[model samples]
Target: MRYSAGHKLETRERLLQSSALSAKRSGFSTVGVDGLMKAIGLSGAAFYSHFSSKDALFSAIVERELGQSLERLSGQGNEDRERLERCLKQYLSMAHVEQPESGCALPTLGAEIARSDVQVREQAEIWICRLQESWAQILQSESLAWAILSQCVGALVVARMLATPDVQRTVLKSSHEEIARQLAVQRAE
Candidate 1:
């Protein structure tokens, strides 16, 4: 059987999107190549045609997820304090806490990324630093940017760890409040 010219690219994209969501919802290391491919309706052997290896797919997922995050968080060339605040509110929300697969990858995948090879870690670092750079410009302090970034991701992770919704909401609220306070202080300075 023959396929269209775009068939390969479309199949690859499907694999990437499906695999990324799976990795975010469950740990990347927990899923093998066969599992990843199976999620997208392909056999395990077909995985190599799209990606050289599982690690390659991981790198691609990191790049795609972080790139989307950077776009949503940073906006385009005109991010300001208000925009950054809105981004934070969304990032630290209960919806984000409950929906790991559809949201940012950091909270879910940070540990796995840290344990990945140098190349994968480097891919993540590039996007992470760019995100920080965007926030730093608006916040006017590199340290503050890092702090808020850490706080946001940490808050999500902590919120997800709790069994009760009330405690989870408290964790999100506290982080949001503290981050707002810190931003207010920075603005005053």
Candidate 2:
């Protein structure tokens, strides 16, 4: 009953991807190890082989998700004003508001990350700071980078909180417009 050499790694990846999506859509604390394993078609007993504990899995998920977010939002070395604008538009869009499972982890997982242990929080901070640094390099203002980063995450959280789509859209639109205005001012200065 032996599996291939890659089977373990593949299963681990499947588990991580499934669990991260579940954690994003539902709160991470809400889902149990059995449920997380079940989502990946594995038994709860097998979970220990891939991760020492659920917390370890959580740490891995944060690292994977935030690293991905940094890459997407920051762009490669060629990021310019146009690319940043497009990224912002996508971030503040209705599609992002409706799709928490597939969007940025910050809006969905920020609270959980804040409450997590120091080790987990430190991992999150590393990725978050990397994201801010990339934007700061592009915008040439550390202050502006932090402001826009906070605004974008806050906008997504607020948009997700509203019950109606119209109100949600208004929140997104207002934030996007305000951010654009701020960016223009930064450019002018």
Candidate 3:
């Protein structure tokens, strides 16, 4: 049975979404194309119909996950300190840590992306820079913007790594407070 163009596109989207969730929950390299297609009720052969190769699929996932983050971090026309603070909170929250499949892909996939093909790394890098520049526009400090990006990703990574909920909260709260304080000091200067 043949499918319509629209049906094929929808199937591709479903595959991407399922792949993203699986990649975040499990490591990207560990989830085989065969398993992913089976999870979505499609045969492994159909995977090639949508993606030329698993590497291509990984590139697509990087694009999708980071693209969603870049869109969110871009914010409205107004790039104010308040908006930055809100972004920080959202990024640092326990909810984000607990739901790897639904949250930012940086901390989860950064190492893998670093080791991926140049195209995949570039996909992640371009979006990451966009996010940093967005924050820099508001902060009026490029160095601080880079620091903010690093700190958020680092804190979340640590928070997710620790097994204790209390430690996770402590990590989140401490980093959040320190970052807020830094911003306050920068504003006062």
On lDDT, the leading prediction is 2
Which residue pairs clash in candidate 3?
none
Ten-residue region with minimum lDDT total, candidate 2 = 75-84
Candidate 3 weakest ten by summed lDDT:
72-81
Model 1 misplacement above 4 A = 75-79
As for TM-score, the candidate ahead, 1 or 2, is: 2
lDDT of 2 by residue, 20-87 (tens): 99999998999999999999888999999899999999999999999999888994756576798899
Q: What is the lDDT of candidate 1?
A: 0.92
Candidate 2 ranges with C-alpha deviation above 4 Å: none
Q: Candidate 3: misplaced stretches above 4 Å?
A: none
User: Can you give the lDDT of residue 39 in candidate 2?
Assistant: 93
**Model 3 lDDT per residue over 75-102, tens place:** 5666467777898899999999999998
Clashes of each: 0, 0, 0
Q: Quote the positional error of residue 90 for candidate 1 in Å.
A: 0.7
Tell me the tens digit of each residue's lDDT in model 1 across 25-75: 888989998888888888999899888989999999999999999989984
